[model samples]
Target: MDLGVKGKTALITGGSKGIGLQTAIVLAEEGANVVVVARGEDALRGAAEKIKKETGADALAVAGDVTSDEDVRRVVNEAIARFGRLDIVVNNAGTSAAAPFGVVELSAWEQDLDLKLFGAIRFSRAALPYLKENGGAIVNVTASFAKTPGAASLPTSVSRAAGMALTKAMSRDLAKYGIRVNTVCIGLIRSDQIEKSWKQTAPEQSWEQFSRDPKHDIPLGRIGETVEAARVIAFLVSDAASYVTGTSVNIDGGKAPAL
Candidate 1:
């Protein structure tokens, strides 16, 4: 259906690929002006071009690192300058880091927090004034591990938990301004990141073996697609989800245990 987000402008971080890219495409298809932010200029431009070509929507790309406050500020400012206003913000920039606590270095934890937690805070804070002006939405992309931690998932789980708390706190505080804050807790969705993870963690395994239908961990017996997560995020940011806020929606294939 009509998501009712036409003409609305959205800024999405980590939009160069994976779920973020899919989200941008979907939003553009729904007639939203989309600004995709990522660190790599080439990939960001490619994503922007793809969105524009596929959906015939206005799509812009900005190269910036979410871990840097300056970059975050630049992204928000540029988006507003280009679109004149911001109606949605998707803090989707992050990487998955899993290591045994004992073996994990302090630096790793700090970096993880900088990217996953502080990144969202920076973008949300930067976009708050613009969002409040028009009553908009913010969707922070977190992980299911935040709700159910697993062994060796140290920094990621901890950082995602903090992100969930951030979402709740922002939702409560921003509600008065007509701004909604929520999160999409991702599960095992197939993406470039997952491919890299498999290559790094199990180089010996063939792609078929590594990507074989879940038929295991996830109850659905298969991994999820990037577009699957993107659609949920699109709904959360659309007028359709006007009443949804301060909540976490797991985009897993029923893989997440906690309700």
Candidate 2:
């Protein structure tokens, strides 16, 4: 199906790997120019090269920290310089920093909020001008835990909750300008970190076996792939979902209890 994103430009934060990189590939395959942002220069460049080689999309790698306002501004300016316009912004840069409230330090909470919450705010604010020009879309990547918090989940859950709130507020404010804002609350998606855990915890088991161990409690009986989450994000940013905003979609294989 055509997503109607041809010739459009997209900017993805934390696009060097995992869901971010996969999302870039999906958008590029659909004929959109992509700018991937991350702190690691080498990884970002490699991701850009992979997108170009695999999808033949114009991909730019921008190395910068999302927590830094200057870096966020530079990333947006650089994207506009490279693509001349921006149609999609994916605030995907974040880490899973969770722990019990008693064990979590003030520094940890501050850092988590800085990266996940303020990071999205910084990027979205920086890209607002260009997005306003042509009516674009913003997809903020949060986690399912944001909706249904469990024991021992602290900074991540709180920060992601803020992200969801940010999405709703942005959607309401940006709708008049024709700019759509939405979010995807993901769960148990496969990534390098998960792969490492799988190997370390159960090296004797096959990946298929490990992912379906039932210990993870995924209702689908397996971990989700990056492309799975990526496709949902791609659809959200595409013209096909023009009417979707001020909402959050759970890409959690039905694992999130709150829906």
TM-score on alpha carbons, each prediction: 0.94, 0.98
Write one digit per residue (lDDT tens) for candidate 2, span 1-259: 9999998999999999999999999999999989999999999889988998899876999999999999999988888888899999999999988788899999999999999999999999999999999999999999998998888999899999999999999999999999999999989999988999999999999999998999999889999999999999999999999889888999988889987
> Which residues of candidate 2, in runs, are more than 4 Å off?
none
By summed lDDT, which 10 consecutive residues of candidate 1 come out lowest?
Answer: 207-216
Local lDDT at 204 for model 2:
100
Which whole-number lDDT from 0 to 100 does residue 96 have in model 1?
85
> RMSD to native for every prediction?
2.0, 0.8
Query: Whole-model lDDT, candidate 1?
Result: 0.91
For model 1, how does the per-residue alpha-carbon lDDT over 1-259 read when each residue is reduced to its tens digit?
8999999999999999999999999999999999999999999889988998899886989999998888888988899889899999999999889988999999999999999999999999999889999999999999987998989999999999999999999999999999999999999898887788789977997866776645437887667888999999999999999999999999888888897
**Model 1 deviation from the true structure expressed as Cα RMSD, one decimal place:** 2.0
Instruction: Quickly count the clashes in candidate 1.
Output: 1
